[model samples]
Target: MVWRSILLLSMINLLLLFSSPPLRAEAASTSTVRPEFARKGALTCMKCHDDAAITQILLTPHAVKGDADTPFGQHDCESCHGASPEHVHSRPPEGALRDPPTVRFSGPHPSSLAERNAVCLGCHENGQAIHWTGSKHANNEVACTACHTVHIQKDPVLVRDRQATVCFSCHTEQRAQSFKPSHHPVREGKVICSDCHNPHGTGQDMMLVKDRINDTCYKCHAEKRGPFLFEHAPVREDCTLCHNPHGSTKPALLTLGVPWLCQECHDGGTHAGNPYNASKIFGNTLVAPAPQAMARGCLNCHLQIHGSNNPSAPFFTR
Candidate 1:
């Protein structure tokens, strides 16, 4: 009876070994398991990151090593910076200071752009970073650290009021445009760059937050995106046809002054091409003067230039 029981136990162990292939394959398909360098060094994070400047990363979400799903949760700083056995060794240098455990994102001797981006993409490949590999910023060799400061508790680019300042560092022309009198309230902190643009790679042209230019503009200017009885072809085609989203010298963010803007498409249609004269614009006569330059020039007559829902407003004059 004892021999029979031992035989049954041997058969069960063999059966379990045969079924283990499927379990091993499932584990292989998930994130690759990395060596635990923190354990090998017999050290804690604070051992090396003792300074306030570098230790501040502990205050952020990246330092939560208990999660097990994230890089930090897996192996602390070594998860992103890489497992550096050499960096942990206390060997005296011969000529120069020893190399870093991993190539850092930003510094006098920073890692290559591809290397820096690859580290960020390890966990951030979902969401907005999905198309980052082929995006304009990637093509231009812009590193993730160029705009993001991960070590700090608060990154300036993440703040709405301070976000534009970071963008203006690279977008000098936009900085000048936003300073114009008739501009979006970017400087005042009311309007922000992220409202229109997605800095993290988007499928749209110019990294727009929305798929289409008009659709992006319609988020704020929904009244302008009308299915009116009289639809202007240019307005339907694109908002950029008449308006500059950045600042302009003209009111309403127009690319040009009213009469001149209207003339871009209207040409010499009726009195559209007629330039404003001093007699009509300045001094008043007995008869009412042509309001070519008075109240928004051509817009004084064609009030519904965007579009008109009214059936009688054929020329968008209503």
Candidate 2:
């Protein structure tokens, strides 16, 4: 009986092994490595590129040969520029784009947008670029090279102070807004575009850093996030309902004057539509304090505009 049990276990192991799929071997690289470009020309990168020229890429991390991930380490120039045997040997026909080196970024006859991005994504697909294929930037056909300069020691877009200029090139409306009197500190460089946005691509709309607008605002304004008994409805819904995120002419970036802004929603009862005049402020000593028209308006009584934890302050009047 013991021998029969052992035989049964052996058969089960064999069945399990056969049922599992075999592991796939890595595919052989299709890119041909051409050493002849360096050897036949008897040239280094500086020979053709010159010290003050594009060969300044050597100053960047891409030129570090010890790191296997970079282009220079992998296939020298041909890693990014495709193996162009013909480019090295002879010139093309007249009027034909004859600039040697397989990948040309900026020229009269540059590589197509897809081809250029493909070269980048080939190595970067596993990094921050993993979601790039379906992202808004990708959908709009925005190339990776559009915002990045790989050959330089320092890309201006990567720096905080200079990054806004890069984004403002396409987002002209935002540039105008940032110039308004009531604006975020983008010009001062205290707040940058990347602080609220992720250009690489996020699941949220507008490439926002957070999934919700209020959540993004609460990153700095945590006092407004509350579970109070008396909550302002619009405050819970969206900040943009009352405030302009970019910039505004009014204080606190308010979309409109207080009573008018409040009247947009709360148009009811006697004083709701009342306009402020000389009589409302300095005219008469009436029963209650004069209608709140001059100072702070609705906020004079409704101090808890965001929310109220007070049990007696249902209208947030306290």
Instruction: Estimate, for each residue in 1-318, the C-alpha lDDT of model 1 and write its tens digit.
Output: 675446444533443454355336546754454433644221244465555566556557775544666655555677777777666664756876655677576557777777778888888889668878778888888788889888777888888788889989999999999988789998777888989988877978999989999999999999988989999899999998888888988788889887878888875535566544434434554234457657777787788998988888898889
Tell me, by TM-score, which candidate is best. 1
| lDDT of model 2 at position 144 | 91
Per-residue lDDT for 185-228 in model 2, tens only? 88666788888888888778888889999998998888989987
TM-scores across all candidates? 0.81, 0.77
Which sections of candidate 2 miss by over 4 Å? 1-43, 51-53, 91-98, 275-290
Report lDDT per candidate.
0.73, 0.72
Task: For model 1, give the RMSD to the true fold.
Answer: 12.3
Model 1 whole-model lDDT (C-alpha atoms): 0.73
- lDDT for residue 170 in candidate 2, whole number 0-100: 93
- Cα deviation at 89, candidate 2, in Å, is 3.6
lDDT of 2: 0.72
